[model samples]
Target: MHTLRLSDEHLIGLARWATDRMARVERPVLAERVLGVAGHRIQDPRARADVLTAAAEARLGLGHLPRHLTQAYAAELQCADEHHKAGHRKAAAASAAKALILAFHRVAHIDGLTSPLATDPAQFTGPLRRSRVLRALRAPRGRVTASAAPPADRPMRLLLVHSANDNFLPVVLDHYRNHPGVEVRVLDTAADPATAPLAKGLGRMIASGIGIRSAYAGQVEEALRPHLDWADVVFVDWCTAAAAFLTLVDPGTTRVVVRLHSFEVFSYWPHLVDFSRVDDLVFVSEHLRDLAVAALPRLREPDAPATHVLDNAVDLARSPLPKKPDARFTLGLVGLSQVAKDPRWALEVLRVLRRQDKRYRLRLIGDSMEPGVSPALDRYRTAFAAELAPLVASGAVHMTGHTDDIAAELTNVGVILSTSVRESWHLGLVEGAASGAVPVVRDWPFFADRPHGAHSLFPRDWVVSTPAEAAARILAVNESEESWLESGHEASEKAISTWGWGTVAPRFDSLLCARFAEIPAQRRVRTIAE
Candidate 1:
């Protein structure tokens, strides 16, 4: 485990060589070498910035190795911060812009690879980037005027803004579409080809923490002005680049709302979004809110957006389908496309259960781990493949890759298992419970030791510390068909009552219709002044 050390000049030379190699031949290994030099060996800020930027640019062209890109991104941002503190504004802006562009490439690459259950990157997105965002956003921006609030008699025009991810929006859309009091429209930035460049430019501006009157800002204003004018409120899902970009441009009189899931908190996107521009901030679970607040102290500031914790809306009307007789031995886990899902943990639980009763089996429902997304995921996938092959061959494990009808699939599953390393909320597990399946959740490692985590999220008896405990719970619950069915019935009732769209719709109504009543009087005055 020897670390490679190189002089600053040699590092620059190696970086240029790697970049050329990457252009001619897409070799992720060469990018890895450059990242190693940039992240570990380089000492001079200028040399480090050049090497990291080269590595990131080369990788962007080749299109892989998000971990390497993330490393370069973090290193370049640090360089930018150092130069800025030293009053080298031009150099700082250059490094910051490079880091920002690299981040855009990294986000696009990783986003194309997996579902929402993706794992944290190799390096955490620390406060360095947030410092820049704070500096940029310290200036007062226009907000929804008191006169712009929608009248109570007329329908409230609502707009849904998303950056490609619409997993949770369909339900919200359908609910609002049918309601007589609301009119909804969608603006998916990723789906629109025209705004892509503008989006990138806005990202650079935000990362640099300078530039408000740039052409990109004007373009964003031109593109979004119609939506801002048409909608009374804009709900942006995921505190990503979209949220950041929206905050940069003044929304004439439209109220802004942003929702944060789990993974965004671990990335720089959260750092880019301006809470001052957001009227409401939503988190799916309290634990995720706690994690987000800890990471971004701005969320806890006196003038910050009003925060709310709401359960993800799940459609459970069709759930609790009658289970097959043999379902008692079938364990289910949904979503394996991400490293965070930890399918191998489910396999271990299956092994433990099968050792006691050979009838026990596990079914994985979702896409397989994507290849060549990031080195960390590739390593995890390689090990997972090794562990899973034998089990699959022996017919003890089944991978039902990417199904549209999850409810139908869950009907054959008796015990639903949440074997994730981390989650804001285990949507699949809740869905399975609503389908009359007993739940066995692993104490999600990322937040397990925290005051409010998986242990607090779910019933204590439903969550376990290890595969053995999960297996024991499974065995005890399924000791008899009658007892298992009864437990599953109770689980179904709870899941439906707690997270079903019918139960959660009222909360959404409150959020959308309450008209900023939740904001403190002083905070309201501050928001108006800003």
Candidate 2:
């Protein structure tokens, strides 16, 4: 037997061949792996030149490639062109650009990639203009204006700003979606190009001499003025980028309510928010409220709006228990994507369970967060992956990525686990409970010692300090499948009846009505005119 150690050129050639083969087989994972290897090989100048030549040859001979693969090759060529341009290698840069243009043309014929690159006049300098990505990502702005008369006798028009894909949005939307006295509009702040870009730009520039009030202040004010004029109340979630943008807009007569979850208080966005614009502040947990108050001095201002603690709404009606005989021994963590969720702790508890009875298995739901976003999260993610790799390989742990139907996923999971270090409210835990999974909370580290923690929110027996304790509780509950099922049934009943959207909707209505009544009718009329 002979072992081969391939040169960079050989590796690049092999990767290209593998990619072509994988694309023919319609295996995205294999194609992705080949692309990764090709990317690594292209780090060497000689190898990169060879790869570009190979790509050009492939284009001429093969005629066309997969859309994704072609795009990847074009991106690699563009990166090579950038490196050449940085080094003033005109010839090399021109070669790379030619290759990129050829690859781009091949893929442009596919659906969703048909925008001609154009030079931006605003960014022109010294007889040259930069070609920005002017494709499908750009959003078309429509004319938005203030409503004429508060939209059908609703006490107020309320805009709730939230992330587009968060699990929390559905719950929040359900609470106020059809409230008679409040017309609620759920604006996905993260997806709004006009406001999101300005907000992000302001955040990056604030560290420099640029005035925090000047960066996106005018843009936000202009974009949101009409909406604010129409809305008598605005609720901004996360007290981070979304809240800061709302404050910058100056809501005029519209009262603003900013909700601070556990993560935002640790970020710089809270400091950037103009507290004077907010009419009220809501926190999911009292400990979060205390932390924000202590961390940000503005919250302590005598004139600051009243702060209230409200639990996150859950549409428990949709969560129904599933049938599984061995479910009593199956411990599940509904969300394991974030470091805050602490999947490793859950793994430790599973280890303890397996020691007692090998029938124990752990299920992890939700995809991991992108590590490029935060250093703290990246470290935690690395450690978690390392811990789970062996357990997963042994078939003791199961991973189900993002799912639309968690209630269905919880069918075989008897014990729901929350090992997070922090939480605004563990919606996953609550939802799991509603699905008939017995809740096992880890006594969130961020507020475990505080007067108001998981201990106050859940039953005493449900909160545990360590994995061993948690494992012991699970074993005791699982001594008999009938008893375990009954306990989970009770938990589900309590969660659905108490935290369901039906009960939470009225509270949202009351808050909006009270805020609207406080606004003078004369000012309301003027707002309508504006």
Candidate 3:
């Protein structure tokens, strides 16, 4: 075996010589490492440049890297600064370019390391010059074109429709409020008291498997027409009674977008939606889209409006609060009023924890879904109440009933728990994480084994398969107060930075813009077919 040895002084001298050589030339390794360390803070140009310079010096010391490798690094630095200025952060885009450059250099294919900025300036340019060029090229020549101006000066109106009042409505409203050049009007199908009596009677008739027209059928049309006439877009949330109402209404020239959360896939409403009238359908997860498409064949038809997966938007700013010192022993469950929430699983976990130490307790929040509404729901509700009653009576579980102030409630919760059988996206658990509660998510059973489900949606370590596993994880987290608080803080930071409204709103804007730009081919094909 060959052996090589160097004295400390010799090694120190060699390091100094390498540092001097790197300072004389531009290298990018150190700059890239620094960029990785700064992470999201690359939004600041000075910080980004510092990172780039450090990486450049490191690469220069390596001595054999290609020139374009350095240029690629510089291009990324410029792109980062430009994107940061444009308010996009562009972290993924910048990182991808850097990776491509490194990959190409490693394979001795430096020419392949071309920067998108150099090759496609129009991609980065505002208002995309190529799109305008294409339109000009496509236009008939010699026809004196009018000035490039909007055909009509009209405020863009949006009709906001939902099945019933819930937590999602306020968040949706907040996203679009104060948006430039748009007017929004909200309509709640379930809250229309004028149709209540008719709905109740129709509900009884529908239960008998008889097809009866809803008393509110005409009313839906009447309520929708004026808004549709004035609106550029109509956004309906949940494929429920509201979707049925919107389908019955003539959209005239307005674009219609419907959002389907997870639970609605199994509901009867999917059968009622008139896809012919819908212009777009939004899903929160790809798994949800797959399930919905499989369950509702209409959605799979080529003529169906475009489908999109847009994650649920969360307001993360309101999540973090000063945590109570005693919160380490506290496990919290928000939105416990539904059987799907499966608070009993949380109770089982609490029981396991109490066996280890009585310091553990579970907090149940949110009103239970009214059992009187459906017999199927009532059966599950009764069983859940029975399981929870003993725990509640023993003071091991505390029920807050329901409160509008979730942030305040979360301050006392150290661990946020989601013990749900199914969910589109558990907003409550995410909100709890935002509130500095260490999230303990139950692997949602409905889609646990499915691709792009809960496991894919959350950090792997945060998810658990059973009550026992969940309890074990909880105990491990609360091993000490300091560890528990640290975990909570980390979870909150992740929630706010990753899923917060500020980060997610742009995605929604992109989806909406794309939806608005596409005229549904279904509408044209259907017109011709008719």
lDDT of 2 by residue, 1-530 (tens): 11145566667776677556653553345655565556455556545545544543443333333334333445444444454446534333343434434433422221111111111111111111111111100111111232133444445677888655355666667556665566777676678766556555432323211122343456666767777777767788777767766665446656677777776654446655666566668888877787667656556656555787777866788787574777777788877665567788999998888888999998888886675543345555677789889999998988989998887888878889989877768888998888889999998876787777788888888899999999888888878878898889988988888778877766655665564554332122112121
Count of backbone collisions within predicted model 3: 12
Global lDDT of model 3: 0.61
Tens-digit lDDT track for model 3 on 1-530? 11135433443343344334445555534533323333223344434443444444454334333333333344344554454345443342343234223322321211111222222222322121222221221121111121121124654666687766455767767667777755678866677664333322222222211122444556555666675666677788887767765665456556678999865654445544666667678898877787777556566566766787777877779778898877888999998666667776888889888998998888888887674644435555677788888888888888888898899999989899988877788889999999989999988876776776779888998999999999889888878878888888889989888888888888766655333333333232133211
Q: CA shift at 210, candidate 1, in angstroms?
A: 1.9
Candidate 3 Cα misplacement greater than 4 A, ranges: 1-152, 190-223, 369-379, 513-530
Each prediction's TM-score versus the true structure: 0.82, 0.65, 0.64
Global lDDT of each model? 0.74, 0.62, 0.61
TM-score of model number 2: 0.65
Model 1 compared with the native: what TM-score?
A: 0.82
Better of 1 and 2 by TM-score: 1
Worst 10 residues of 2 by lDDT: 133-142
- Please report how far candidate 1 places residue 45 from its true position, in Å: 2.5
RMSD of each: 5.4, 14.7, 22.8
The clash count of every prediction, one per candidate, is 0, 0, 12
Determine the backbone clash count of candidate 2: 0
Against the true structure, candidate 2 has what lDDT?
A: 0.62
Ranking by TM-score: 1, 2, 3
